[model samples]
Target: MPGKRRMAQSARAARCLGVRSRPGALALVACLMGVPEARAFDLFGLFGREEAPPAPRPDALPYAVRLQGVEDDDLLSALQDASTLYRLRGEPPPDGEGLLRRAEADATRLVDALWGYGYYSGTVAFRIEDVVLGGDAAARAAVRAAEATRNRRLVAVRISVEQGPLYRLRRIAVRDASGRPLDLPARLTRVGDDEPARSATVLAREARIIDQLRAQGHPFAKVVRREPVVDHADRAMDVAFTVDPGPKAALGAVAVRGTSSLDPAVVRSFIYAEPGDPYSPEAIAGIRRSVTRVEALGGVRVREGEALDPDGRLPVFVDITERAPNLLGVSARYSTVDGPGVRGYWANRNLFGGGESLRIDADLSYLGLGQDYYARRRKLAGIETNGLGGRLAATFVKPALFGTRNDLLAGAFIGREVQQSYLSDAAGGTVALRHRFSDTFSVQAGIEGQVGYARDVLGRVDYRLIGLPVSVSYDSTDNPLDPTRGIRLTASATPYPSFLGSDPGLFVAKAQGSTYYALDEDANTILAARLGFGSISGAGLAEIPASLRFFAGGGGSIRGYAYRTVGPIGPFQLPIGGRSLLEGSVEARIKITDTIGIVPFLDAGTAFASSLPDFDEPIRYAAGLGLRYYTGFGPIRVDLAVPLNPDKALKQPPVALYISIGQAF
Candidate 1:
């Protein structure tokens, strides 16, 4: 009796379905009791910790969804998603004639479902037992009368679907205002004949076409019309978009608008979009970066002329808003090895009003009571200095120098530093010219003069060092601090002609390069490598100041060795400066997540006594693993390393610890 009553309730609900689609409820019922299934159920929803809905009574009706000639999983899945009956989850039961109403509505829904899959023509047939309710007026009347029964009864309904042929693109084209194909190529979007004719995909293609035209010197390009014609007979579609790409234009006179106090010519100096050059989308986008770099402007916008002049050129317009002239800023950071440090600076962005800037920056290292533990505990005999020291500097920058794309930089510095076998107190002045070739390349040449008193294994002395430093570099890394791709290369040649309180003049030549390659586009995993070499000509290592000579080891070099410890050994069993230095490193950077990464690395090379690197002497090797936590600026690195061939004479640490910002290379 109980089983019969449950069947009756399910049947009654099915027969009550109607032309108005109630998909969730109908689909749930079909899945539970009408679909071609063999005794599957949610027994009290025990697995998900939920209770199953009540079962249908004996007199309730049931329904099923049966497909015919629909083999495509994509089309079949889309149909199930679009169908109201198939969409039903655990929904409430329908009234007496609900099944008839839902069945009538499904006819239109099924057609739209087919169109989504590029099938314009489809067939949906619904029936109650042997009575066909599809366009057969006589059979439909009979089913309607049966479903109107006052007494509780059982019923079964079937939804037979025939998904028709998939439609595809037949032809597509673009036209200009005069109904003629423009001179410019319509090559951006591809409406391949065999591809599915999805409306969204076609619209996206249309948008890209208009964008491409505008970016190609057509500033007033516009898309006026988009038309899609569907051919059901051939199962194909033809699409087109009418565009109005105005005449091509070149850059004309520049106007610096909205500036009341600043020099108008200075804004022109910053503009890379010169007269006679083709209009550029990239140059417009680069305005934000350029404006933010000088820290002079608070807000700015670029506006272009609406129509071209008789010269066939479009004028460029720039509107400006200024920021506060003087700014004061301070920063502080703490590290176990370097101790806490603070840096403060005062800057005037518009000192001379021609984009001139003056900045006075000072930094104090060794803040608080934190000291360099490892260096203090195990100081070499001749090395009197035991902790890291401090430095200070001030700089002046003059932009638009002589109306040329060059910056004149002049700076002065005073500093103290403690190395493994030496200590230095130095003050110096420098004047330099920095020229930019492009956004990613530059060259700097400077004349520097310095005087210092140093104490090393060779004892303390006051020394003079003068040099003409010239450097050229190329950098294309996407991120300045945590680069995943691109290469950075720098070559420098500094010739020092020794003068007062100095030995022989020396020409120091050095070159260093770092390269990174990401395994995938996401750049989660990176392979990084670096190589560096330095040579001192015209003098020996001992002839120049110890501070200027070449030395290796340290966190940026052979990590397991102490600072300046990778070169030739000298007095007090400490490593002395060398004439030649070489170093190389390779790392496999693995990102565990967005904010965390791990690195395994190997380092090799050493400082040599000869002018050119000599292989006769042993090269030091260090291998290690590092951990990285990314910040808004870059990655913070912590590494542990061990030296393969440590000095057998002295007691050495088996492992060394280092902490810093960015990759080791």
Candidate 2:
């Protein structure tokens, strides 16, 4: 019967489940059941989730510090924090004391969390509430009073090297957005396993490495590190920054505007960028280099502008402004090979519209050489002079040629040169044709002829000789000004059809090639070599011209060797210059800073002639050391060469000093 009654009651309770439980009703049940006070918990109080306790009376007896339990310092301190306010909350609680007690309890909880990492000892104290402000203000005043006393005193923050000596990467594994490895230094490392790692320095280094990678074409390289792990077994710590290299998005399009006579397409060809190519800040900076190369050609100015499309698609625009051309310039330079040089020019690119160029230039130089051989008795030296050199040229170039992809230029020049050798005087004229095959390659060829009078070292006047000269050249460099990578080749040869007076005809031939290879992000080296051969023979139709003999020396030949000093024409008295020539310089370019560099070089060359005196063997030599100053025009160079072989006739030390523009070769 009781079970049935209970079931009925349970059903009724289930039906009344939606009814709200009355606060403290559980306490009434406990009283009815007579549960022991210390062991009992009021279920009604638990389920009701009582509202915040009412604010304590303001004038009540203040809580005191005596509530601290235990005389044992450690236990007492712990209990002080745990039971801080509980002792004041007993029945008949002190006025304001209950509020202060609760404050202390909250404060203790905060202090414990703070000390968890080794701030071993901390204090939590509170002040009695002052009856100053009322309501919320009064509550705040009480809180402040307690907080002021409960302030934590961090006695000693006993700290230990948790897990340090993190060796951060000296450099990130530079990768593109697609996560491909870049041409980075082999010694570059981005992670460290050193003990007692310097957290700050390592972090800073990672940031720097990431920045460097971005500049080098890895735009999306990032580093992620885990909580450092201290390996007690090995007595060392390990730190790592996992790499997340996003795709390397290269420059899509580089567009230029603001030009009339100069074609935008032509300008682009001179720049270093293409669709789907990896993007690089250095490449972007190349815009300046491109503009500088031809700045003298057109009245043009260029500056970097905003990136049009950043989504790895579309072209980037480079703002350019072309000032109408109306300018003139003049310069003079001297070199051992090119001789005392004078250059003056005037240009009007927009003459009569349609990008037509009208330019006039005058250049004059004198080439001379004198040398005495020790073994041969034939003392020989002479002055070879070339004068009255000037040119007239015109061009019509369109930015868009043939409505497709190409650049066209047609120009011509007429010049006269008067040259005098130890035994002859010569004069000549030249005409040329140039064409651009593509952005990477070009071809240029020209024809020249010369006729002049000659007076031998004996001062006997002779009839004029004639020269027929021809040459072809090719080059492919994205940025001609600062060709970080590319190749250039040129070949030329000249044959004298008429010998000086009744003398035999002379034949001379020469070829040159230069190449550059980038080894890494910051370094490149150049290898250059030269070869030449010529002769003079007394014959009729096949006779070699007497004044057309070939000789190598001066600034362009081996550094330590004198001008025209390499060749084999032996057994003649020691002439002042050698006849045959061969020279080479191996230069290593190291970039110390953005705009600074140093080059260490080895130069070796020799000169000889057929049937020279016994002591007239080709002048063999080797030299070392040089400096380079990079400029807007080119690298200005200063070189010092000490001869590996010192001639017996020289009175001073054989150290050659040279200053020049561009590479020696």
Candidate 3:
């Protein structure tokens, strides 16, 4: 009776509000009359009033993780890397159910990771909110209850690891495919008894065995089977490999492919292997290197035939991709003391259908307003007014000359150079035979002749000269422009006999070397150092041409000083050049970002008046900082240097600026 009376009253109220037939009118009237149950019902929702949307979940969920019970850093790191829950903690699952699935998957992955590191009996356990996963249903229910109350707050996840004693290899065996013991050298199989039974080491040993057989003229060598047995009681593992080494063979016919605009004869000439010779991997690699060295070829691939020829010999093929025949490029540089310079070059990689290259270069310098500022400031008495200095040169290279490692190199150059010390106009040519003993080492012997007019503080003179130049160089660095490891060394001597020159002749000898050290694995930090020495003998300083004398101050030598200003000075404070030179530099290259780096460097040494460096003479010192913007080709460098020990008499600048490409060394 009471329920009917209340319904009637609500209907009467809805009618009074002029909405008696509306579907939600009763609810609205109940809300206005302060009924608690009616207040909980949403009148607006019933009438199509849109409710506010739920907030978006974050891309990465908030969580806390802990790893426990592993003392070995390497093992711990490996385990973490293998666990999806640890690696992808930021990307949490959408719900509690998803998280449970992830936890279960991680257990299997972590155990496999441990086994790879020789921990065959390792175990992993995960706990969420103090409830162990994979436990009874009640435990899972507790975890879910906890998750439901988290309100998107941080959830605690813990991983407990128990790594048992490391398993060691008890026996290792290598056999033929027939299960008969093979007579392979023990060193070929790197695994040994009592060593940790790491899966990687076992796999690598199999590869090593196969490689040894192939290197010994077995082209069809392969590993037929690999078996490992683990004994948990003994905490040891036994491994065995069965190999199949097919019949030994020699090298047979060689063919060329993919040569378009390249002469087949030229490609054949670079092949160091001859038919009937024993098959060798090194020989194939050498042939590939030779073909790749030709600038006209962009890609070179050497492949062995899948099946031996009827003669029971391996066949080889050389595949090549040709590059454009002609190339043109331009480069620019600047320095406060040397002004700005620009260089341009054009090259023909394949001339006359052979691996011959011809290149022509032209360069111009002293294009800035401060070209002669240093000379004028020093009040040099006989220094010429600065003008555009330039050079024009052409070079040609004929590779693999006369079917040998020797290359024929020839070049001619004519140039006008205006320096603070002197001015000269000269033309010369050189012809040389360069022999490459290896990729990292080479030697050259050449004859050169020059005719030039030079003017310095001593006055103007015309001279003719001829000389024999010999040099040896070794470079093991990884990059020519920006090296991070290895060393580069060069030694050269050129002697001009008095009978071969209009003026008294001189002998010049020089040696220089640089080395790089990577301070970290990624080569983000590097330490580099360089040293150079030069000497002029067989003539007095005044008797030799100024261009032949040694001078040590410039962007290439001791930075932070004007060009040629670190050597002996003659009358009117003008550099007279020197008979000997010594210079050195050291720098620390540190990368702040992937494409940006900073270098702090120190440079020292100078030229002396004697035929060798005089320790008694004071050496100049400079220090600077540099900025580098790394690009695909190389680093673009900008340096600001200051002289540590300034010579007031020479009026050196407070700071010097240089902008160029490549490392200082």
Instruction: Kindly list the per-residue Cα lDDT of model 2 for residues 141-259, writing each as its tens digit.
Output: 66556444332310110111111222222223444345565454454444444312323333454566666676766666675432233233343334344456445566666667766
The residue-by-residue lDDT of candidate 1 on 1-665, one tens digit each, is 25554345324322322111223222223333344222112223222322343344435444444545677775665455545544442342254356566666666665555554566556778765566785557455745654553234434456777766777877777888678865555456455668776543455566677678878988888777656666655777676667888788888887877765566666655665667888766656554345444556777787788888889998777778988889999999865445677889999988888778888988776622244433432345445553557788888988768767688989999998665566788999989998866556789999988888876666666667778899998987767788899899999998877553334577889999999999987998999999999998886566666787788887988888766678787765666778989999999999999999999999988999898899998898999999999999889999999898976753456888888888786
- TM-score-best of 2 and 3: 3
Local distance difference test scores for all models: 0.69, 0.45, 0.76
RMSD of each: 11.2, 20.2, 18.0
1 or 3, which is superior by lDDT?
Answer: 3
Q: TM-score of every model? A: 0.68, 0.50, 0.68
lDDT order, best first, reads 3, 1, 2
State the lDDT of candidate 3 residue by residue for 375-484, as single tens digits: 66233555465567899999999887765778899999999987766778999999999987766788999999998987788777677878899999999787878999
Q: How many backbone clashes does candidate 3 have?
A: 0
Ten residues in sequence with the least summed lDDT for candidate 2: 153-162
